[model samples]
Target: MFCFQCEQTAMCSGCTGHAGVCGKTADTAKLQDELTGALIGLARSVDGNANRPTASTDEAMLAGLFTTITNVNFNNQTVQDMIDRILAEKRKLVPDCTTCGSPCSRNDDYDMNKVWNADADIRSLKSLILFGLRGMSAYAYHAMVLGYSDREVNDFFYRALFAVGYDYEMKDLLPLVLETGEANLKCMALLDKANTETYGTPVPTTVPLTVEKGPFIVITGHDLHDLKLLLEQTKGKGIHIYTHGEMLPAHAYPELKKYPHLKGNFGTAWQNQQKEFANIPAPILFTTNCLMPPKASYQDRVFTTEVVSFPNVQHIGEDKDFTPVIEKALELGGYKEDQPFTGINGGHEVTTGFGHGTVLSVADKVVAAVKAGQISHFFLVGGCDGAKPGRNYYTDFVKQTPKDSIILTLACGKYRFNDLDLGTVAGLPRIMDMGQCNDAYSAIQVAVALAQAFGCGVNELPLSFVLSWYEQKAVCILLTLLHLGIKNILLGPSLPAFISPNVLNYLVEHYKIAPISTPEADLKKLLAK
Candidate 1:
């Protein structure tokens, strides 16, 4: 097995031989590759068939891609099941392909090994397109959950998938990479609209880190629909709910927060789950990725839903019945007393929900502060968190940013310093936690709004992007930035292993994207720019 679709690939290269760094075994990784290959075959079938994409085909596309995302599904059985579904869908579209005497291999499954062994430049470009689609799938799936779907986003999946299966050269594949970004931008916007319209626009809300005594459930991942379901099921049952990881933003939604028993957040980000979940006295539900293989001590306390699955874990089905998780929490009965958990910085609580709507509403005040010299700059520092050694760079960087600058952040990476009180600038907290990973849409909105208010392009404004990426979601978000022609991004704790030297050089020369250095040095260099 060989895979390098995540930031923490083995030794900064592809994971090979056995288990991946994410604890994905050789068998499971290969199964995911098979799943992706089948999906591409389905795309090809739909691309040439008389039938157009149906709801089931679109859903299978989303689910198949989403299953391959790092940390989302570690169960080989489920991976094979998804592959079977994709093949069945392909057969549905092109029934004659299997028995055709003059068969063209166009409808046959793609050999992923061809991609893994392709020329370096071609391989890098194709990797970008494939990974970007996987990332976009998460956002698209979330939107579909709320009954929202974009035809453009759905159609682009087939185009991109077909390109991956075909022998596209570097030059031809390059535009598809950016096109994936453009498509993902639309996908994210659809999800943003779905979320805000369904749950109401998120408002500024402070959440405590303390877990009140009682039976409680901890829901992690970026699925608000799942969170709402769990919250509703556990309602009036003496079982409180605590948002964990990306679920932290759910607290800001009026529909979710309306539950009286919906309590505070628990622990830090996903990377810290093994240590944090070890002794937590309640069951944890995983709605999506960032799920670590459960430890023996807490194995029975873990539950999974949607595409996130682990061997032997309790799974909530499409019916959204969370009874198994609710029962586990009841049996555990939580802590004997209220546990006052603090964040990494020892702060008792952190805040989130400063999304695009919240920030843009105060656009005039932000512009006035900039004009009055009360604000120096704006920094968007956000992405997924990992257990990599250099991750603390984000915490240190956020710590050392000038007080006059506002630090806008999203995703689990913000857990590194969200608890730190960066104080207020222009009457707003210096650190604004904008929703989840998809909420990068909100950050983009705020940036465009700021640029408009300041009478300059986004790059010319007093703003800089200091991003840290861990998985495909971050990959798609970065592509969206490049698609928008935003420049001078400082990305780290390390660059992707999938990016070949030529592709890296292309990004460096064309977009001024650079690896992050020391916080002080980067701050000095960015300030100078």
Candidate 2:
């Protein structure tokens, strides 16, 4: 099997052989590819057939794409089941495609191996589109769970899927590649709307890292609806709920935080799960990607839901019954006393919930600070965190920023220095935690608002984006920045392995995108601008 859809691909190239770097075996990787190919076929059937794709077809496509994302589903059986669902959906669309003597073959499942073996430039472009769609599907699926669906976002999935199967040149694929970002922008908006309308807008919230004694559950990944459901189920049962990883920001939402038993955050980032969750005394449920193959000691307590699946782990099914997880937590019984867990930086607690709404509400103050020279600059230092060596640059970068500058961060990457106590700037916390990775939407909103208030384009403002990426979600978010013509992004620990030299060069020349160097050097260059 060959895979290169993430930042941590083997040696910065495609991962091939028995297993991927993420612990995905060749069999699982092949199944994911097959599922993707089947989704493309399902998209073709929807394109050819008269009837619009059914709701089940929509869900199958979303789940199938999401499952293939790095570190999401490691279970071959579930991958095969998703592939069957896609094929079955396709059959419903073109019932006689196989039976007709004069088969058009327009709805055939496109073998992904063809893309893997295509010309380098074409391959890179298609990877962008495919990976971007995978990222968008996660956001789209989350919105869907909250009963919010956009026709434009849903239609783009079919359009992009069909294009992947089609033999397209670099010119043809490039536009679609950016269009993936365009669609994802709308997809993220739909999710933000879904989350705010359903849960109410997030506010500035400070969450402790201490886990209170007694029974407790740790919910990870980016799904708020899942957390809410689990909170409702475990309520009044003496089970305290703790946010982990991306779910760390769920504390900011009124609906979720209203739960009296909803306690503090646990763990640092997704990459440290093996070490962090290994000795935890409670069940940990993964609602999305970023599952590091659970260790033997904790695999029994790992519960997966939605598109996340692991072999032999307890899975909370669509019924959303979290009884098994709750029972596991009860059995473990948690720590004998309150566990005071600090972040990676050793701070007792970290703050979050500086989303677009929160930041924009103070737009006048921010503009005034900039005008008065009280604020030096704005740095958006956020993205996925990985076990890669060079990732420390983000910590150092945030550390070296001018005291007058405000650091706006999101996603798990912020865990690197979020607990550092950067103090305040312009009467605001220097390091402002913005929701999850999807909350890159919030960062964008704040940047656009700042630009507008300052009477300049986003790029012309005193802002710089120093981002780190780990998976396809980062790919789609990067594309969204490019779509908006945002420039001068500093991306590292390393560039994606799938990007061909030409594509990488194109990005550099067009977007002024560069790899992260030393924090001091990058800070100087950014400040000099």
Which candidate number would show the highest lDDT if scored against the true structure? Answer: 1
Off by over 4 Å in 2: none
Quick one: RMSD of model 2?
A: 0.8
**How would you encode candidate 1's per-residue C-alpha lDDT over 1-529 as one tens digit per residue?**
9999999999899899989999999999989988888988898898857799899999999999999999999999989989999998888899788889998787888889999999999999999999999999999999998999998889999989999999878889988888888998899999999999999999999999999998999999999999888877877899989999999999998888899898999999898899999999999999999899999999999999999999999888899989989888989999889989999989999999999999999989999999999999899998989999998999999999998999999999999999998789989899999989999999999999888887889999889999999999999999999999999999989999999999999999999999999999999988887
Q: What TM-score would candidate 2 get against the native?
A: 0.99
Worst 10 residues of 2 by lDDT: 46-55
Clash count, candidate 1: 0
Give the per-residue Cα lDDT of candidate 1 at 434. 96
Which residue pairs in model 2 clash with each other? none
Q: Per model, state how many residue pairs clash.
A: 0, 0
lDDT of 1: 0.93
Tell how far residue 405 is off in model 2, in angstroms. Answer: 0.2
Off by more than 4 A, model 1: none
